[model samples]
Target: MNIWTFDQEKDLNTTGAGLIAALLQSKPKAVLGLATGSSPVGIYNELIDMYRRGLVSFANASSFNLDEYVGLPVDHSESYRSFMNEKLFKHVDIKLENTHVPDGNAPDPDAECAHYEQLVNDHGPVDIQLLGIGHNGHIGFNEPGANLTGGTHVVDLKEETLKANARFFPSFDDVPKQAMTMGVASILKAKQILLVARGEDKAEIIRTALRGPITTECPASLLQCHPNVIVLLDRGAGRFM
Candidate 1:
């Protein structure tokens, strides 16, 4: 595990974007495992700037998002699909047909999960997987629990997760109660993992998940088992380190 702390937001964003850009420069066909939420927005913005400046190109890269709210329409503003389009995909040269986000509204969600997992398997060993740690130390939507699923599956959102996401919806009740997420095993298949976190609110959990024991209770703790993991944190999130 390689941990890096940044004093300024731009530094963190540039470093994160630089890592991805370097990967694309070496392997234009690299498979990217993407994430949504506030943690990665700055990195996405930096990447957008890089693309505009001809410093990087996602033209041949394919991407698979880590998770999606279970019942949200793809067109929904908060849907991971829309979030990716608004944040990164549409801004870069990546082909829309080569990007994948689980179909949250699939009639047979179980089948969708299986299909999604197979799709990932077919196109990856993702070269690099981007992740944002949830308040409960959840990775993707693989929430804290006694046992963690090992493939793409549907999950019941935990109270903390629901509350955290409630801010995005008009009302608490508007947030989706379920989600489809890549499992720990699926995520571990990635050749490299880039975990990002920011803000003082994430400090404690970041310390626990990275420095504590490897346990199912804190899903992100499992990243400790991976051989190649890079953690990027702002001063606030890295306070305890």
Candidate 2:
């Protein structure tokens, strides 16, 4: 695990975007595992700029997003699918057919989870897996628990998790109580992992996730199990470290 702290937000985003650009340049067909959240929005913007500059092209690349809200339609503005399309994919040259987001509305989400895991196994060991930590140390909506799932699956959102995400919806009542997320075992299969975080609000959890005990209670701490993990943090987020 390699950790880095940056003073400027742009520097952090540019550095992350550069890493992804380098991977795409070396392997045009690189499989990218993506995440959505305020933490990654800047990085995605930097990638969009790289695409416009012709410094990077995702033409042959494939992408799998980290998670999605269970009840949100694909077209919903807050859906991970919509977030990706609006934030990065629509502005880049990537083939839409190659991008995959878990079908939140599938009749049987457990089946969808099984199918998603299979799809990832067939096309992945993602070359680069990007992640963002939750206030409760969740990753991909894999909330804290006594036990954690090992493949893509559905999760009943924790009360805190629901409250955290309610900001994106019109009201607390509008927030979905469930989500579909890549599991800890699934995320560890990535060839490389890029974990990003910002703001003082994330400080304590960041310290616990990256430097404390590896446990199911702090799913992000499980990143310690991966052989290759790069963490990018802003001053506030890395304050404890």
Candidate 3:
């Protein structure tokens, strides 16, 4: 594990984007495991700037998103698909056909989960998997629990997750209660992992997940087992470190 703390937001974003850009430069066909939410927005913006400046290109890269809210339309404003399109995909030269996000509205969600997991297996060993730690230390919606799933699966959103996401919707009831997410096993399959976090609110959990014991209770803690994990933390999130 290589952990880095940044005193400036731009430094953190550029460093994160630079890592991805370096990977793409070495392997144009690299498979990317992407994440949504506030933590990665700055990195995405930096990547977009790099793309515009001819410093990087995602033309031949393929991507798989970490998770999607169940029951939301793919075109929904709050959907992960829309988030990616707006944040990074449409801004870069990556082909839309090569990008994948689990179908949250699939009629048979179980089948969708199986199919999505297979798709990832067929296309990956993702070169680098990007992640954002949730307040409860959840990763890709794999909430705190006694046991964690091993492949793509549907999950009941924890109350904390629901509350955290409620701010995005018009009302608390408007947030989706379920989601489809990659499992710990699936995420661990990535060749490398880049976990990013920001803000003072994330400091305690960041310390716990990174410095504490490896346990299923804090899903992100499992990243400690991976051989090539890089953590990028803004000063606020790295306070305890």
Best by lDDT: 1
Clash-forming residue pairs, model 2: none
How far off is residue 114 in model 3, in Å? 0.5
- Across 107-222, the per-residue lDDT of candidate 1 in tens digits comes to 99999999999999999999999999999999999999999999999999999999999999999999999999999999999999999999999999999999999999999999
lDDT score, residue 96, model 2?
Answer: 98
Cα deviation of 9, candidate 1, in Å: 0.5
Q: Compare candidates 1 and 3 on lDDT and give the better one.
A: 1
**What TM-score does structure 3 among the candidates reach?**
0.99
- Name the lDDT of candidate 3: 0.96
lDDT of 3 by residue, 1-241 (tens): 9999999999999999999999999999999999999999999999999999999889999999999999999999999999999999998999999999999999999999999999999999999999999999999999999999999999999999999999999999999999999999999999999999999999999999999999999999999999999999999999998
- Give TM per candidate: 0.99, 0.99, 0.99
Candidates' RMSD to native: 0.5, 0.6, 0.6
TM-score for candidate 2, residues paired by index = 0.99
lDDT of 2 by residue, 1-241 (tens): 9999999999999999999999999999999999998999999999999999999999999999989889788899999999999999999999999999999999999999999999999999899999999999999999999999999999999999888888998999999999999999999999999999999999999999998999999999999999999999999999999
TM-score computed on alpha carbons, candidate 1: 0.99
Clashes of each: 0, 0, 0
Report residue 115 deviation for candidate 1 (angstroms).
0.5
